[model samples]
Target chain A: MGQNYLASLSHYVPELLACLTMFGLILIEATYKEEEKGRGFFFLSAYLGLGSVMTFSFFSLSKPAVTIFTNSLVIDPFSSIMKVIMVLGTLLAVYITSQSKDIEGNLKPEFVIMATGVLVGGMLLSSANNMLVLFIGIETLSILSYVLASLRKGDDRSSEAGLKYSLYGGISSGIMLFGMSHIFGVLGTINFTEMAAALKGVETAQLAILMPSFLLFLVGLGYKIACVPFHMWAPDVYEGSPLPVTAFFSIVPKVAGLAALIRISHNFFAVEGALNIGWVGVLSIIGALTMTVGNVSAIGQRSVKRMLAYSSISHAGMMLMGVLVISELGTRSVIFYSLTYLFMTMAAFMVVSFVNDKYGNDHFERFNGLIFRYPLMSIALAVVMFSLAGIPPFSGFVAKFHIFTALLTKKYYVLAIIAGLNSVVALYYYLKIVRLMVLKDAESKDTIGGFNILNQSVVVALTVPVVLLGVFWEKLLLMADGAKIFIQ
Target chain B: MISLSSYLFISFTLFIAGIAVMIARKNIIAMMLGIELILNSAALNFAAYSRFVNNNLEGHLMSLFIIVIAAAEAAVGLAIVIRFFQIKETIHIDDAAQLQS
Candidate 1:
């Protein structure tokens, strides 16, 4: 038994290293004096730690799937790819925080520490294979995120964001637990493998209980991914929190939730049954509704940050469509979409963070005539917006194209139509920013202190993938195809 | 002797009451209590089901973890609530409406 545990530990190296990195960050933060502003050593250690984590997960991507920690957790290519994306998102958010003046200088290190903690939770969530681990992972992600949302101490808006997030989060998780308890009672197991095995033989009476229980389970995850009905906290939390926190929230938690959701959908619902039909039906309705509501709500938003929040909800809806199809093709497309979304969201948020730092607000008018001042940054934002709106010649378009293919394969034509229309609606708001940057006159000729050469280069570097992937996406599609969800 | 159905009925009542508290209560702390009620009801359900049906250890283990996690969640939730109170000088849930569009 001890030897078996050792073997499992060997496969768990990446998560262990990520935990160590978070601890190292805390120790480093402690050693810094109160008056110190730029803790260069702290950031250097953070970069090294996260870089090592990303490298380890990347190497593990091609290895065979292994269920570690006594079958409670999985280390698979699909999860490895997700961890890579989440860590990269965290790394980029940290870099954005380091450059932007949005977060107080003193509080910046705390952001790094909390973000690393959240990343750990995300990693756990993406790989969880058992009910207990999944519950723990979700709680870890939620608790740390509450602190991150209210990082601006004494700020009313920030505290309120944290409050709303925690309240809604608590209620949803509790409801999910109720659902899970009933499932455990009926299935006689919490391990997903055993549960799936048990599901094969359930009677109609069991099916009735299982269906609602699974929906309850979905409430927690859907809340994390910000789907409709469970998405009330998203726009408020996104707009109220600091920009870097918002960026992290959009990428890490959403991807982790989607990864878990895909795994669950693939595991238990892939087989034909009333359960499968019911689950897919519910997912389809939620997907279509989430897309329409998010897009329509975004059209009327004046705050650029809030608009981005709505747009992200719509993007999640699109990803949900991929999950509902319950095929390898659907899973692969979802993975590819998330990878593209990481770059587009990061680049867009970086620009917005700089703008918010300068004007103290992120309204549409703040971006007036940005091209004249910093054309590189302006062009990068435009590319990202176009990509986000699913225009051609961007990775966003390719990602959406793959999703459409997955939908058509399943004959979910109505969903495909809804998603296509949402993209067009998205274009109007996305292009509005572009128009403001290009056509409108500058409000002031003053330089934005946040857009230094280093920052501009980073923004441009991130945008490169958004444009390059649109044309040369076949290679990535091939890679995603290899990242099959390992079903035992 | 207490039956399984009786436990389920009690838990169901608690669940409904928790939801009612959350929906009807205007106080933030009251809402937090509602969340606690919901979590406890689930924990009770797990323990009941474990004792009555499965006879396995997983349900007991789940309930234990639920207890530990609920405390942690409450700690964070309360901290955020304290922060909200400090800023707004009120614990009314309506005061949290600043982010509403």
Candidate 2:
């Protein structure tokens, strides 16, 4: 009775505090003047961000780290690392909302609600030791995201994006849930560690259940990350949602979902349960297809968001390689890669926001003669594009190198070769964005003239992280190493 | 009081009906009802599965939470769909293709 009470208390406190703050922000926004909403949004995000950091710091780790929640909600170094990334990434994404005029009228507070909801989900997911908790956490994030994607209810494109996205999301969830049932039946446990232990002695009956369940889980995760074979909704959704929502969607959810993927794969599939060497072929084939299809589809895209959507799918492919490594090095590589990728992806989308606002169009050619027009934004766009293309001295390149080295160490020779070659293929499309911004002719001077303070601040804040992470990435790499030990 | 097979069969029947609703309905509200049906079937399954397999109440409790969550989802999803329909009229999803705002 006491334990159940404590569990309920432990579960509800954080969730309640988070939800109350979100509601309070909505109420506060009602009294807020138009000019005050931006600052209100910023302060709310800051409060939430600091609170999350404190929770992560106090609950999970001492100097070496604290304790956990019943040892089920793991407050380990690995979770700490992902939690920090999620909190910081979400903080920036929230601020991006304040700067953009994407949320019209009183609907702006909904962004706060949805974004905070996503953060809560991500945080819980990173800490989930029980499959039950993990499912709820993941579903919470997905449900909120589907709403956020289509929240621009006034926009037809937004509705389409929402419906397509929700349909796809619902199906994935169903498949995954079905798989979870099989897994639960086979292992007879909901706790991940216990499940892992049970998996060891189980016979073929369990394998039949385990393998399909694992596949279903991965399929659902794949949709969130927008990897190929399950990436169809991304282009339309990204293109249709408000720019800030797109930016938030691309980075924050991917990081959290991938973190869950890492935990699940490392805990269940990497060693104990059916993780024979043969699984390598499965990972390799999926990874190769994700990259190839993403790059190929992106090549013909005209819309910036559509292209970035495809681009993120390709990056998901790259992220999958780290999971395939399933080693401590691979875990570290994924963590490091995500940290860098967050900044670079944010920087790319910030530029997208600018172009969308200034010209009211996100078509690739809409950026004609951007270099002469908005010189600062042009440079940022080029840097993000080049970084995304894996060019040198950029964070994306550094992270890509880390993954390549990790894969090479694992001696997954084909995956290593495919990843390296795919990076080259990726260059063509990322360069296309850069080329449009830098070398192409400006159709009009309309986009370059105005520079709002909010826009300038967001662009600068996002850009600094990308370049700095690229230039001096070793310390971050060391942190990834720390987290890796926990995952492995 | 029911046999496990009958319970399973009933739940499966309900699940199939939900799938049919999901496939057959063009009305957004009806589709949501279909989702509720599907969730109800899952809840029934959980109770049945637990009775036959584990003899625990955890499954029953999870199904309860699942039903609660499905209610929340239906409320939110239908609101969004209704708002969308107001603007577009004729909530036939095929007509709403201006998806690049």
Candidate 3:
């Protein structure tokens, strides 16, 4: 038994390293004097730790999938790739936090600490193989996030954001647990493999009970991903939270939730049954509504940050389409979408964070005539916006092409058409910023202090991938295609 | 007199009452209680199902974890609520309308 446990531990290295980093950061923070700013060593070690975690996950991409900790958690190529994306997102968010003036100096370390903790949770969630691990993972991701959302301590808006997040998180997770308990009772197991095997022989009456329960299960995850019904908290939270925290929220949790959603759909509903039809039908409606609502809502927003929040909701809808397809191609496309999304979102948020810092608000008017002042940064923002709108010659287009290919392969024409229309709507709003940047008159000649040499280079570096990935996406798609879900 | 159905009925009632409380209550503290009620209902269901139907430790374990996580969740929820109260001087849900755009 001990030897078997040792074997499992070997597959658990990346997660353990992440946990170590979180604790190490906490301890390291204590040694600093109370008034010290720019905890230089703290951030350096954080980058190194997250970089190593990403390295470990990248190396594990080729290893055969395995169930560790007694079938509670999985270590598979798909999960490993998700981990790499999440760690990169965290690393970049930490960098943004280090540079952005929106968060006070004293609170910056706490941001990294909470972010690392959240990263650990995201890691667990992407690889969860059973209900228990999944619940634990979601809770860990959520509880810390509530704190992160309100990291601005005394600000009423930040406090309100945290309150709303916890209230919503608490309710949805409760509903999810209720559903999971019923599932455990009906299926006689919490392990996904055992549950899937049991699902093969369930009675229609059991199916009746299971259907509602599965919807309840989706509440928690849908809340995490900020889908249509559960997305009410997202805009408020994203707008109210500090910019770096908002950037973190947009990437890590969403990707982790999508990864988990993909795994769950592939595992339980992949086989043909009445349940399959019901699940697909429900997801299709949800995906389409999510896209429409997100895009339509975004068009009316005045704040760029809030608009980006809605845009992310729509993006989540697109990824949900990939999930409902439940094929290798669909999974591959979602992985690629998330990878490109990470860079596009980081670049956009970096620019917005800087602009918000300089002007104290990120309204649409703030980006006016940005091209006249900082041509490189303005062009980068424009490229990212175009990429986000899914225009060709950008990675977003390539990613969307893959999803469309997967959707058409499965002959989901209705969803395909709706998605195409949503892209058109998305383009209008995305181009609003681009238009303001390039065509509108300058509001002020005051240089944005956040656009120093180092930050400018970093923003440009992030945007480089956004433009290059559109042209050279074949290599990344090959990497993403290797991320196959392993069903036991 | 006591069977699985009775236990399920009670837990389901708790679940509904919890949702009702969440929807009906205006006080932040009361709403948190509602959340607790929902969590406890699920935990009770797990325990009862473990005893009456599945006859395994998994349900029992799930219930225990639920209890623990619920406490942790409540702790964080109340902390945020306290912070909100500190800022706005009110725990009313209606007052958190600053980001309504």
Candidate 4:
């Protein structure tokens, strides 16, 4: 028994280390004098701690999938890959925040702690095997995000954003819990595997209750991912939060929410004719609607941040196409798209954050004559924007290509068509930004300025992956393919 | 003894009321109360289901967890409400539309 306990503890070493590091940060913040803490110490320590945790988790690749804590959490390739993505995402976010002028001085430690808290929650979410664990993981992530969204004290917009996010979050999760009560009542089990097993014997009449329950459950997941009809809070939250937090919201939770959705879908919805509630049809309609709403709404936005928020929503819709297929290829494409998306979205947000830092806002007009002044940054932004528009020779195109191919392979022709049209609509807005940056003459030539080395490096670091992944995507595709083993 | 269906009906009523309150109320604190009502209804459903459907204790345990999570959510929600009030001097959500496009 003691040896078994030790073995279980060993399985969680990475998470334990991350938690300890977070506690250490809190302690250092509490104990140290404001003058003695220095400028970069918190961020540096956060980067080291998160980076080390991410690097260490890579070793779990060689280990077999294990269910610890009485099957509440499963450590597998899928969870490990997602954990890496989330940790790396947080690490980059920390680096970006460190470089940004928006969050300074006393707020730095709190930012690190809250972001790390979200990362830990995301990590747990990816590994969750039971509903109870999933609930805790999501709450931990959501609560911290609510706080992070409001971190800019004295900013009315930031506080309002936090309030809106929490209000939506609370209502959705409450509804989801009500749905969970029904699911538990029907199956008498919270474990996904057990729920799947029980679902095989469910009667058609029972599906009446089950179908609505599942739809209600989707509400919580949909809110986290910010799909249409459930995405009202996203633009407000994204536009109001600090840039790094907005960037964090764009990537980490979406990925983690998708991870959780994929896990739940695989366990409950994947079996043929086992529990026919017409989920694919439902998901397809949701996918089409999400992309259309996101693209159309994005077009009229003047604020660059709000436009990107809608763009991210549309991207989530495209990724949903991959999820709808429910096959190995589908999951593989989704994972690949998510990985590529990380770089492109981060690069775009990094540029936005830098511009926001410099000009004190993220207005499209602010980008005029950018190429004439900051040529390198403009070129980087142009590349990132083209990639986002799904143009060829960039990572975004490859990601979208995988998703469309997955839909075609599954004979989801209508969805493919809808997605294709949405891409066109998306291109117009994306290019509008590019045109402003490249062709529109600056109101004044001296407005744009060169970026600092750290900011430039971050942009370059994110851009190289977008370019390289377009050319050398096979390796990452292979890794994504490998990650699908856990789902199967 | 009360049947499971009656408990479910009562809980469903509470859930609908909660959602209605959430939609109709402009005050942030009232919205939070609506959320709490919804959560309590879920907890009630879980407890009822645990007694009627399952022979084990998982449903009861889940309700307990939900209660704890709801408490945490309320704490955060109240804190955000206070912050919003500080910034805008009113708890009406309509007054806090500074970030809208």
RMSD of each: 1.1, 3.3, 1.1, 1.8
Question: Candidate 3 — which residues are off by over 4 angstroms?
Answer: A480-488
iRMSD of all candidate structures: 0.7, 2.8, 0.6, 0.7
| Model 3, C-alpha of B46: deviation from truth (Å) | 0.9
What order do candidates take by lDDT, descending?
3, 1, 4, 2
TM-score of 2: 0.89
lDDT of 3 by residue, A197-257 (tens): 9999999899999999999999999999999999989999998899999999999999999
- lDDT of candidate 1 over A230-282, digit per residue (tens): 99999989988998999889899999999999989988999997888999999
lDDT of 2 by residue, B21-101 (tens): 878877767777776766676667666667688776656766777777777666667767776777777777567566532
Q: What does candidate 2's lDDT look like per residue over A365-484, in tens digits?
A: 987788896777788878888889999988888889989988999788888888888899889988987777777787876644335666766777778878888988987666545444
Task: Kindly report which residue pairs in candidate 4 clash with one another.
Answer: none
Clashing pairs in 1: none
Model 1 residue A347 distance off true place after TM-score fit, in angstroms: 0.2
User: All models, DockQ values?
Assistant: 0.90, 0.40, 0.90, 0.88
TM for chain B in all models? 0.98, 0.87, 0.97, 0.95
TM-score-best of 3 and 4: 3
CAPRI-style class, candidate 3: high
Candidate 1 segments whose C-alpha is farther than 4 A from its true place: A481-488
